[model samples]
Target: MFDKVLVANRGEIAVRVIRACKDLGIGTVAVYSEADKHGGHVRFADEAYNVGPARAADSYLDHEAIIETAKQAGADAIHPGYGFLAENAEFAGKVESTDGVVWVGPSSDAMEQLGEKTKARAVMSDADVPIVPGTDPIEEPDAVRTFAEEHGYPIAIKAEGGGGGRGMKIVREESEIEEQLESAKREGEAYFDNDSVYLERYIENPRHIEVQVIADEHGNVRHLGERDCSLQRRHQKVIEEGPSSALSEGLREEILEAARRGVDAAGYYNAGTVEFLVEEDPDRAPGERLDDDTDFYFLEVNTRIQVEHTVTEEITGIDIVKWQLRVAAGDEIGFAQSDVAFDGHAMEFRINAENAAEDFAPATGGTLETYDPPGGIGVRMDDALRQGDDLVTDYDSMVAKLIVHGSDREECLARSRRALAEYDIEGIPTIIPFHRLMLTDGPFVDGTHHTKYLDEDLDTERIEEAQAKWGTDGEAAASGGDGTTTQELTIEVDGKRFDVKLENPGLPTNGAGQQAAGGGGAGGGTTSASGGSGGDQAATLEGQQVTAEMQGTILEVNVEEGDEVASGDVICVLEAMKMENDVVAPSGGTVTHVAVSSGDSVDMGDTLLALE
Candidate 1:
């Protein structure tokens, strides 16, 4: 076993990796950015280091800083927990080449071959795995039109290095081909540093199913079964469950075998997920299951531990993360494929810090005044926040995950309702109300909900009613600290990180308080804090001003100082929480002044431009 391992991520996932390392009797090291200096993961690890600033590009995604920190901490291996540089093949190659250090994932060559969508599709096709009809890397808008002509309307343009709906766009007609194609390419470049994209025949109503597979260096592979993630919003999964209620026994077996076959053909190792899009029969009854002849197509391969892996763990009684460590240490699989048997049904609910009624807008700020999670049999809470910890709005909004297990799907749903009701979080907005509403929803409870159900079919008024009944009111102003204070400083001695604290007798309270959390409304209020890297506020500007709705970095400035634009025209693109959003003109006008550039970071309410 390795002596020590460094976790190159943040939030609950980082803490999860550290705990797994500790279970194997290995020392753990943590690296955090300036915004995460007081993160729970840093406090749990044996040693921690400050990598860079709050911006992810300068901190969590900085390859050189993370590698150097691992070396200085005397760690022998590095584990990337999901996001950031988890599936980055170049970073894996760098770690592989570093002496005396091991990368706890697949080989760089295998990652490059499977991480790209087109290449993986080729590999799966060659392995006799059913794949959706799609094109290779496309360059122009004409290519998209041609594909749509053959595949019919509603084509999906996906980025080469994209997953979890980051760099994917949907075009329903020829008129939207050019704009959607450009937006997809821009998001690809901003998120994955790859401008390449491909086309696929979009399945209108399909269940998002995925199989969890793990392999070792000795050619031993195992599949833990399948998970259904059809409940989604904006193409991102909201709730995931294992042992799908919509699949027959024979159909489930086929999917499991296909997942194993694809991974084995790609020569992949460690933990990975093989996702598929299974077509749904709308004419079938509510509780009907898909037969063996049902159509299913390979979607993509997630090259790391998934956010919903806990569901599989609960049902199969397997320690997937520990297996990741053991496989990296050159251990062979001791159990056969037949030994993997699921015990019960499990569901994982992502406790994101967002208001679901208001289109799921991410929360700006606020402290966790009352952070209480439910406990008992068959309920697991994976989180890193304490009672008084302030919510971090710089990264993903998912602060915790609630996984419930039971003997059957009905029992699982029943337990989930109770668990969600028991979860208490104040001073910030969360989607607990939405989860509760889903438990009572007809299609979801009957296992007939598809990937587009939330975005397309569900009535918005029901969501509003749920939020009004059960949502938390986070509009109250947060109280600043008392008189006494302690300041923490990070110092380095001989390239090793050490934290220093200094006490002060009398100090004034923070007059400029933190940004209030989102309430059950359309928009969250402003912040007393100053403007970010986007320069000063636009108080002097006279025309209609465009402001940022969330904290994010500018990826592109579409308008100049005096550019003519119509109403609803995109003015700029902002990258936040690993997703791209376009800031558009509220009304038709000419740009009077621009306050931000392509790479500037902006906080909520920061002015981006002014229009007349």
Candidate 2:
């Protein structure tokens, strides 16, 4: 066992690793950015260190800083929790060479070979795993067109070094091939730093199934069963389950064996996932069981712990993370392949802080006034934040994960409904209503919802109906934060110093709340303010107030003052949580004023421009 492990990540995943370390009686070190000086993970760890700024590039992803921090903290190993630098082969290599610090994951060589898409496909092919027909590293647009002509339209352009659906683009028609190809290349470079892309025959409807595998340096390789992660939004998984309801017993066995064989063939060690795209039979109905002849092909390999790994753990009773650390420490595989056990049906719902009705857009600014999660025999809440902690808008929107287990999928669904109803949160919108509705929705209950179910079939009106019953937006806005902590900072104004109490929203004034001055703290970017009652028009003055749709940094402003733009013309682009969103003109007119610049941070509903 490691004497100390530095967690090179943040939020729920960081908390997850820290808890694992504690269970092993291992010391843990947590790293945080300026924005997360007092983050939940930091609070839970044995010790914490400041990395850099709030931006991930400068903080969690700073490879050098993380390695240095591990040495300083006297950590014998470093655990790169999922996301951030977890899958970066270069980081893994650096840790491997860092004198005494061991990397608690797969070898960098294995990661580089298996983490890249094209390379993984080749290795899987050599291992006799069924692979999707695709071209090699595609460089020109002609390659995409040629592949599409051979494979038919609706080809998928995927980044060679991408996973979790980040650097992928789909071309549905011949006319869109060129444009989508360029867009795919751009995203591939921007997200993965690799513009090399490949084309494959895109399956119309598929269920995403993955097998969890762990191997030891002693040559023992085994699989921990499989997980069904079919429910998704814009390629991001929202819900996941174990022992796919769609897979036949025989097919399941084949898939599991294939995953184990594929990883073993690549000489991969430590924790990894072998993902497969199970193509739905074209003639099969929604609720029909898959036939013995149903086709399943290898998708890719995720060389790190997954967000939905809880589902696998609940069913298999396996401590995957513990196994990861043990394997890295030269520990032998605890159990043989046949000794692996899986019991009961389990499901994991990603409790994200986003509005489902509003296209799953993240909350701009809000404090967690209430964060009461559910509890019981078969429920587990994995999270980092506690009540009154402000939501971190600079990263992923997932606030936590709620996993439920039961005797079967039926009981699991029932338990999910009860747990979701009991899961209380305030001050920020979440997709809880969406998860609640999935329990009752016939397609989901029957385990028939495909990856495109949410985006393609689930009606927005139905989602709105569910939100009305379970959503907290209406009530949360009324409820405020609980006064708990306090901070004081000094700011210079006209060479005069004044002690001002910057109140957190929904908390009581610290004697002089209204007179609180902001912008003196680390995360002091924006604040909501209102004009005096008598100074501005009494109730409201109506012009045209163009506002931001979500909280983000202004990446580029397309329109300047007095510039004309038609309705739907993109006026600016926003970079939020590593995603680029276009803020466009709502109505055709001249820009009266540009309230923000390229480098300004903004909150949702803050005016970006005004038009008359």
Candidate 3:
């Protein structure tokens, strides 16, 4: 057991680690960006410190600031709760170098070895783990062209240091080889600071599966079974489940064991995931049984806690984070591989602040008004936002996760539907409707859905209907749901702390975003309120408004006032979170008012142009 642990992340995963540390009677320290000073995770932790500004690069990713905070808090260990610096091998090495400071993950050397895609592929191949046909350290477009010539079109060019499909590009033709390869390498360098890439034979219609393996310094390794992360969009996992409905009993055991072997080969310890792409043969029928011949290719290794670890925890009855702390403290895995038992089916739905009806674009400048999550016998909601918390546009869009368990996959689907319907959020768009739509989807219910299901086969109209039916409308605005106003009053008591009971204080303070004091240090994120777009707005005829569909910063403006344009023509481009979205003209007409410029920031429903 550690004396104190500092969590170097934000949102739900940070809160999860804090809770686990509390259960172990370990003191906890939380680091937050100025944007997350008043965040739920900060409030829940025993002590909190401000790292930097709202931007993650200056805050959560600022290793020196985090290290300073950890030393100041006297934390013996730092638990990075997925994302941010969770898998940064350099940060881990720094923590390891510091006296009495432990990094709750695999050794930094192991992380560096496994973090690179090409190296991990070679290790897995030597360990007898199946790997996709690929090349290592591809430096030229000719290599991509050569690989594509042999593997046929649709080859995957992936960054050596990237994951989550960030620095990956697909080449479907020989003419695209040169451009796509360079683009992949550029993205790799821009995001991961590595300009290296590899080429792989793209497996069409594959189910994204990952095996969770926990290891100890004493050389004990255990596999907590596999998670079917097949349901995805843009290569990002959406719905994840344990004990995939598609895998046969034999295939399941094989994949799980292979995962352990690969980790063991890497000298990996603590929690890690080995992702695989399980090929769904087109010739096979939807319900066709899989045999030992079923093929699953190695994807990549996540060297830290995963976003979907909750589903594995639900089925395996193990606290993976707690074990990470214990393992880092020089404790051996008490249970052997045989003692690890899995039961039932568990599924986790990522409740992200994105509009599924509009291609799952990230939503910004929104608040969690109602903020009600589902609760029941088999349901677990992991989140870190209070009702009045504004959406932090600085990092990932995932705000919460809903995990459900049942005796089997069938019951799990049913329970998930019930739980999703009970979940409520307001002030911004969400992908809950998409998750709810999947409950009735044939491929998903039957467990025949592939990784490209959402991108290739989903029904957009049906998703809109679900969103209109189940989603809270404009009436469910902020804490002032009645359409009034809110006031903030800060007071000090006993020179110790602060607490907010924002029931009533005075009149609203216009649109200025301010910081108030609270128990965790400072209050909620820096937010600037825009005037509301009330009343019935015109949607047709000569006067049509091209309003911002979400909160974002304008990247470019394509039209000026009095310019004639056609419907769907790009009016402006808005960048929200990390995604770029196009705002287009509603109908063909003359632009009457150009309300924004390229550098102007806008919120949801803020008019960018008016066509007459």
On lDDT, the leading prediction is: 1
Q: What number of backbone clashes does candidate 1 have, counting pairs of residues 3 or more apart or in separate chains?
A: 0
Q: By TM-score, rank the candidates, best first.
A: 1, 2, 3
For all candidates, the clash counts are 0, 0, 0
Candidate 3, which segments miss by more than 4 Å at Cα? Answer: 283-287, 474-612
Residue pairs clashing in model 3 are none
Residue 185's lDDT within candidate 3 is 75
lDDT of 3 by residue, 1-612 (tens): 799999998889999999999999999999998878788899999999999887667789998998989999999999998988988999999999988889999999999999999999999999999999999888888887778778788899999998988779888898898878876876676567798999898888898889998899889998988999998888888889988878889888888889999999989999999999887865656666566779988999999999999999999999998888889888998898888888999999999887766567676557776688899899998999978888886677888999999999889989999998888786777788788888999888887888888878877788867765554422211224223333335678988667343442323322332223331322243211122341134233135566666665676688877789987787776766544567776678898767788656665667677777
Question: What is the C-alpha lDDT profile of model 2 across 302-373, one tens digit per residue?
Answer: 999999889999998998899988998899997888888889999999988887766776776578877899
Please list the residue runs of candidate 1 whose C-alpha ends up more than 4 Å from where it truly belongs after superposition: 476-545, 564-569, 578-580, 586-592
* Candidate 2 TM-score, true structure as reference: 0.85
What's each prediction's TM-score?
Answer: 0.89, 0.85, 0.81
TM-score of model number 1: 0.89
Judging by TM-score against the true structure, name the best candidate: 1
lDDT, model 3:
0.81
Candidate 1 lDDT over residue span 151-190, tens digit each: 8989999999888887899999899998889888888887
